[model samples]
Target: MTGRGADQRTPALLLAAVLLVGVNLRGAIAAVSPVLPEVRADLGLSPSSVSLVTTLPVLCFAAAAPAAAWFGRRVGARPGISWALLLLAVATVARVLGGPAVLLAGTVAIGLAMTVGNVLLPPVVKAGFGAAAGRVTGLYTAALAAGAALTAALTAPIAGLWGWRVGLAGWALLALAAAVLWRSAAGTADPTGPAPVTPAAAGRGPATGPSVWPHPVAWAVGLLLALQTMLYYAVTTWLPTLLVDRLEAGLPTGAAAASLFQLVGILGALLVPALIGRRRGQVGLGLVVGAGWVVLFAGLLAWPAGWGLWVTVGGLAQGAGVALSFTVIVLRAHDADAARRVSGMAQLVGYGIGATGPLLVGGLYGATGGWAVPLATLAGIGVLYAAVASVAGRPVTVGGPPSVRDGGSAPVGPAPAGGRPATPPGGR
Candidate 1:
């Protein structure tokens, strides 16, 4: 009875750890945005350099994603998470003491650590909460949104009180605390810590399967995820600037608008997967989100003062867009190992592609000296996303589970559904 009780408690604790980890990941990125203006002033960074500061993490996400899968196979997920979280904490804490170069380097470390979390956490969730992926994903992503919102909203004030360095350093504390919590809660040895995948599933190298690359679902999910991430990071990096320059708003109001964008995004990220239970539901929501994107950009330009409501609409749409992308990550893969693979590939390609938004928009700004070009650039991506989602959002399975060859997966073939256990393609 005690053993069973302990078993039951383990999963709850693991979930908590995932939530904490999620919180740390985004705060590291979002906090910097709010404090970026001040950091720019302190460092005397040009607009292009500033764009690079925000762009570095996404680029790291792309570069380091494959490594995350490698680490999960070699070191085990819990240990990888622990070390990554510690790295994030240490890097964030120590980075602020130096010059802009140090700051950029620390962000690189943070991005790498975050990539591990991004790759490993979903599989861990799938292993533990097999019956409740949507709810768990919602909770996890909500924490992600909460972290971004909290940091986005608070960093400005924190910087005002102390300085941008302290505001930047503050996120390190969250990472540090998350590290401690993860150790205490989830650092236990096997059977109690993170659930492990089969030897064939996780241990196989990246080439074991042609499942995801050749499949249409993977491309769609990847495309959608990429575009949404591009939009999210672009706005997170530059939204404040847009509000301030375009609408002639004050800094605080612009910061608040940025904060509000993420805060409402939490709702969309949290609710979409749960509320829209059917697989095809995301497809339908794509149309809605597309329309909302139109409204979000257009409404902001047309009724600039009524920005609050428009912000909410835009936030909800983008949030739901992200939520759907994540859902597709889990839903489109056959198992936890596959989840990690799909996640790695999706984020790798997605973030790699998405990283261009900031530079392009910033270049546009530098060239045109206005927000119109940036706004058009963002809206144009939305238009492109509509076409991709129409296909990626379709009900289809990725190729199949990871082929173990002789000793790995058995009878490797097309996944039953788009990674679902029993459903077939388009079955719902």
Candidate 2:
């Protein structure tokens, strides 16, 4: 009876740790946009260079993905995640301590740490929750959006009260908290921890079976993720500045708008599990999300004053888009190991493509001296996103034949040898 109670308590604690860690992953990055103006003034950064504050982290997400996966395999997921959180706390503090060079360096460190969390968390969810992976993933994503929203809304006010340095560094406390929680949870029990790699398995390397690289469905999924990631970061990075410049709004007003853009995403993230339950096909959801993006950019271009409606719509779409993309990743893989491999590849592809978004938007704005061209560029990306999502959202598995449809319920292959039965993807 005592053992049963302890077993039950462990998963609850693990879930809590996962949520706390999710909260830290994005808040530090999101803290930048609200105080961008102040950071620019203090650091003497140009418009294009300032965009790097957001862009560099995403670039690191791509650059560090392989290493993160390797690290997870070498050290179990719990310890890897705990270490990443500690590094996140250090990086968050380090970025605030020095000039532009230190700031960018610290940003790189933060990104590298976050990549581990981003890559490992899904497998942990799948292993820990089993049939409830979809719902838990929605919660995880909601936590992510909530953290971003809180930081976005609070940073401006905090900066107004204290300096931007203090406002930005304050988020490190959350990282520290998450680290402690994760360590506590891991100490209790870690069902999701990596299996000990025997000498034979170690010699075979981190991945076995057919590689996800040759798979077209994997590429399509990566493309969908790329578009979603690009749109989310680009908008988050520049929305406040765009509002301030185009509407001649105050910084606080602009920050409030940015906060709305992030806050409403929580609704969108939560909606995904419900949508997955009702909808047979993901193509329609993808199309609708794509349409929302198009409408958001077009609305912004046509009527800058009606920013509230456009931002709300855009925020929901961004949140759903990301959650849906990850859901597909989990649904398509045969097992947790495959999920991690596909995740590594997909994120590498997705974020590598995505990292270009903020940089390009900033450069276009700098070159053209207006938001019109940049907004149109994003809308065009939306069109392409819709087309790609149609393919990516199909009810198919990663390594399976393209014609096979699992109805979005499970992976294609047989259960991994000597492991637990392959769990259904997402919902029951």
Candidate 3:
């Protein structure tokens, strides 16, 4: 292809690669949850052992996030993602080939590989898509939710026909395909050469960027992501059982409700980009998402008959919550390097705190023998999430001087190269 022709095609190819990578990020983990019973029975595993298969990846996400950022810095984001996908495919196959020990080991490998993808993708989107980052982020988040929903829905049927091992291992095909596509799209050139010294990096080398952990704005964004993730996981883990116990629903109905919770989230994910285009201040949007969570939990508490409405609304909120959090991460960072650092720090805090949600909700139900207290606790969390989202949604960049004490708002920092403002005009 001619140089101009290749340049024209690169964006589309990169987008396709990104979507494919997003699909593989959660499918392997989601597949295991649906076939846990078969896995447990066949392997003679205890309940805790079975739980580890699902929980190990989240913990690994936390533990490996910094490593992912480091890997991206060395190999560049595209190569980093491609390498991670290759490992994910191998890990998926390995996890299903043997007994319980092999399974758990494979799970750890899957988590670590996925952590690279999770941490690097936002920076890739920012660097590749530029001003259209929010819309691309929405598409990426939708792909993730769709992959998870499809895997969860299909795995049980596949396991019934074949076995749990085949069902689990089949997702390796997705990872392999993504790896091949990403390799082709990214080409052989490594983009990790020295970045231009912009005003944001004035008086400092490219390698000497500030850490995101010390920034209050980064903390706000991380807390919002953490709460959203925690609530989503906790509710997803228990919503079916909650329906069965509280509303006297049959297993089929409960299962359908759970499916709705996953599927409706796609709409929520798509909604964010449109909202970003129309509105400058995201605090109102954040409030709406927060209200969705509160209404879902409160409605379930007051009248369990409205379970359908609650689940649908909660799914939308959960989907939008994640997309918004990542969009903020992209928009708030002055450049791709900052985006990577902030993304890593945010996800480390996010998954680390979120990994406890299922355990906490289950423990509460076991002790209380009812969903009332647990649901109430989730409602309280929804309130806290709303408060944090307000802070996170502000038009403030990480490392920028704070103009307010409560993390309300701050002026954009120095513009990067090409004189483009770090944040887009009107606070997008």
Candidate 4:
């Protein structure tokens, strides 16, 4: 292919690879969760064992995230992800052997594979699309959601038709297919661009040396990601129960409300990021979205009527928050490797912090014997997130910020997940 033609074709290829990666990463996580009860019963697992099965992957995400950059740096991003998917497929399929040992080992391997993919995929996206970061990330994030939703929605039914093992391992076929397609399309890595440098070779360490952790902007993005993620997961965990128990809604009413929240949330997430595009400064949008969630909570608490409206708006803000968190990871870093490093820190600390949300909310509910205090506390988090979003909204690179504080420069942050800024493709 001619040079121009190769450039033209690469985005389509990258998008396919990215979308497939998205599908595979979350499928392994989501697929198992829905069938977990069946797996628990079949294995005769105790409650503690079941809880461990559920919690191990999340803990792995926190513990294994930093290694992702190290692994990606040594092997190159494309190879790292390709291999991770391969491992994910093998490990997921291994569960078909049917034993606790295999299940635990397979789950651990799946978590590792997903951690690598989660950390590295953004850098790959940035390297391939450059200016189209927002569009690519929006789509990628959306696909990740789709994968989870697809598996969660279907895994139970599939298990009912066949068996729990099939349901759990069936998604591995998607992973294997993705691995094969990615290998064929990439073919010893794309010829269109040179293999990117490793972080060590490229001196991707923060200016302070030893670590980028010292940088305030990095912390800003990391904290923003953590808080937003915490909120999303917490709401997801408790929303249905809150509807059914607190509001005295029927089981179907609660389930329907939760489904609406997810659907509207996904749509809103995809649409809201476009509004921010290239121009920076998301403080206004951040505050608006954050406060919107608070109002939704208050409205739900007060009247518990017109819930569909509040739920939709809350879901919109939730999706946008998560999407924008990923966008921040891309926008705050200067290059692909740097992006990976920043992603590592954000996800490591962010996910660890995020894992607390569900437990905390649940504990509070038990302690108070009422949703009032728990819901109010969640609303408080929304306002706190808005305040932090103002800081993260400032248009500054994480490790290479113009200064620690932007020197009173006009702040920047919002970018709708739609059109990407038109930077040169080779900018990274």
Candidate 5:
């Protein structure tokens, strides 16, 4: 039927929109990093104040995640993402509209909009492509990394030619474009747009239920997600600044270095999933990633004066770690529904928890007048990651239909098993 054909195309279109939105997520924040001094000087900001501006969007991401997930289920992913894009576009322009205070306020909108996509995406994938969860998640996440990379690479140059305001406003156009695609593909009403919805489980509503929070599985996934996001945002927010201040790379080099770090991550993010997907040792892989994080943080702490190579190595390792972390989210959840739940839990708690990294790192740096303590903290977190990943990385499946796991929740709690339907904590 015509309807069925349109339905099939819907997921692909939504995916396209997701990719576009992902591209814009980092533009505002990453673009500002290389030019922090310029902005700070112009805005009369202290290091701590600048750091707050640098880190606020990520913090907002954590704060807004739960609300995003609830809104997605209550409204729909397509509708939610579409509206988010619209608001984000508006906010992107707003970032350029006024002084530091106004820009900071607008960043909140950007952060909130980004969270909507973060939480809803897993469920959207699960809802649309039930059987191909792994590949689909991999593809989607890779696209997200690609978006980050593109923005990271372009922001500084764009800002160089035009003022930061123009650079910031450009991203709004991309957000608008995504909004249009999302609308066309998803339709105007029912925001989820034609994705299949099964009957709600006994005493469970998709948006609000015992499933949303305070669940064991949710806690585990949330921890992992938070660890991943914390590291990623820390890098994004601080790397360029570090390169400029510590590595003596200067502004342009700092921006390029930061972008390169993320670029390496794009490769790792895409490749690690394929290599590890078939392995039965996800927990072990996580341990390895955690070890990598430890090494990364150690390198950062011990990085010699003018030793950009060490910094580069640190960035690559961190990128790989983050990519692996994301891969685990897909691997850990058994079905799309379970992935949705897991993604929601991880994002809600993970990002919320992760936001602490930036604030704490910035705060510590402010207190200490150096980066040593923050680097130490990052290493400490890495150690925790190793231990946790060791437990979480084992080859396991959970939450499928009755036929898959004999009608019980699987290892991570039932997607490849009995469909326990978890929500992504970050609001996915």
Candidate 6:
């Protein structure tokens, strides 16, 4: 075949892998939330325990992200993700075994496994489809939202029919399929270099050398990503509960509404980034979206049951904000490698911070016996997002090519996940 034919086939194959992996990203996480009450009853979990059940996965996903580079280095990104899915499959089965301790443990393990996919997928997009990062990310992110929506809508009924244990275990089938597809792509190896070695001091040392980490623009991107994730996951994890418990919406209606929120988000995720990819300064656009969130939450507090459609619109705005934020990792980073590292750092700190949203909202509701305080807190976050959005939306490259930050002509830290030299594709 001609070189062009080979080149054309590569993207098609990679995109297939991306969609497969994306489908599994949230199937396990979403499966649990819809069936939480059933699982709680079956396991004899208290109300507090049920809450913890949902919280562990978010926490574990965040905690596991920082270590992705290390794991990717050790096992290779494709292999690592495959292993992660395999492990998640095991955890899914374990969760079906009918014990609180085992269920919680398995849930955490599944979340931990997911972190590998979350961290590496962006870098994979950058390295494989560098010129079209925006478009590719949109497809992948949309698939992720679809997976969440599917599980959210189907899990409860499936559980009712076959028991929650079987319902939960059913997700493992998707993961296993993803693992097989991932293994298929392993044969078409891209050239990645060796892993970087950091000394004990390296971990404790400055996050970036004074030259890179202190870049104001980098900080802006990090904060932007942090707020976007905070809001997205907060809504995904809590909105159904908010509707059911706070608004007195019936359970089925609550789940259906939240599913609509995700469906709207999937549309936003695919549409927004395409518009922004060709633009330079996106701050103003971000502010508009942030303001939309203000309206969404404020209306939620004032009119919960009657405002599901409005809240769903708000979710679209929030989804646009997140897609913009994620796209910035590539636009702002100097090159593919910088994009990878920045993606890691942004997700690491951002998700760690983001995981607090649901817990905080839940805690506030518990402490005050009302949604007022939590709504106030969420609004406060929206205000902060507006302020940060203006700065992060600007187009500025940090750690340029050949610079340590950009992952350019030189080795940034370690080699790539393929265990080769610390050089880009063909360079020495």
Best by TM-score: 3
Where is model 2 poorest over a 10-residue stretch in terms of lDDT? 198-207
CA error at residue 2 for candidate 5, angstroms: 9.7
**What lDDT tens digits, residue by residue, belong to model 4 across residues 317-423?**
87778777777777766666567778888888788887888888999999999888888888888898898788776676654334533442222232447754445
Residue-level lDDT tens digits of model 6 in 1-428: 33233234456776788888987887788777778777877789998888777777767656776687556544445556777888988988987786888888888888888877876676566666655665677677777777887887788888889988888898888888888776665433433432455541211223222223456666777788778777777777678788887767787877677777778888877776577655656777788778877877888888786666667777787667767777766566554445556666666667778877777787888899977888878888888888988877775565553344453222222346896423322111
- Clash pairs detected, candidate 3: none
The TM-scores, one per candidate, come to 0.82, 0.83, 0.89, 0.86, 0.78, 0.83
Name the best candidate (by lDDT): 3
Candidate 5 local Cα displacement, residue 370, angstroms: 6.5
Instruction: Give me candidate 3's TM-score against the actual structure.
Output: 0.89
Worst 10 residues of 4 by lDDT: 405-414
lDDT of 2 by residue, 203-277 (tens): 124344346776677788888989998898789778989989999999887878777877788899888888775
Which regions of candidate 1 are displaced past 4 Å?
1-9, 37-48, 156-163, 188-211, 238-253, 278-281, 364-377, 399-428
Cα-lDDT of candidate 6: 0.69
Question: For candidate 5, lDDT tens digit of each residue in 229-292?
Answer: 7776776667677766676767787667666667766665665657564654566666766776
lDDT for 324 in candidate 6 is 74
Q: What's the number of clashes in each of the models? A: 4, 0, 0, 18, 36, 4
Find the number of clashing residue pairs for candidate 5. Answer: 36
| CA shift of 309, model 5, Å | 5.1
Q: Write the per-residue lDDT of candidate 1 for residues 269-353, one digit (tens) a residue.
A: 8777576555543567677777677677777666778889888898998888877777767665556656766777788888888
Supply the global lDDT for candidate 2: 0.78
User: What ranking emerges by TM-score with the best candidate at the front?
Assistant: 3, 4, 6, 2, 1, 5
Worst 10 residues of 6 by lDDT: 200-209
TM-score of 5: 0.78
Candidates 1 and 6 compared by lDDT, better number: 1
> RMSD to the native, candidate 5?
5.5
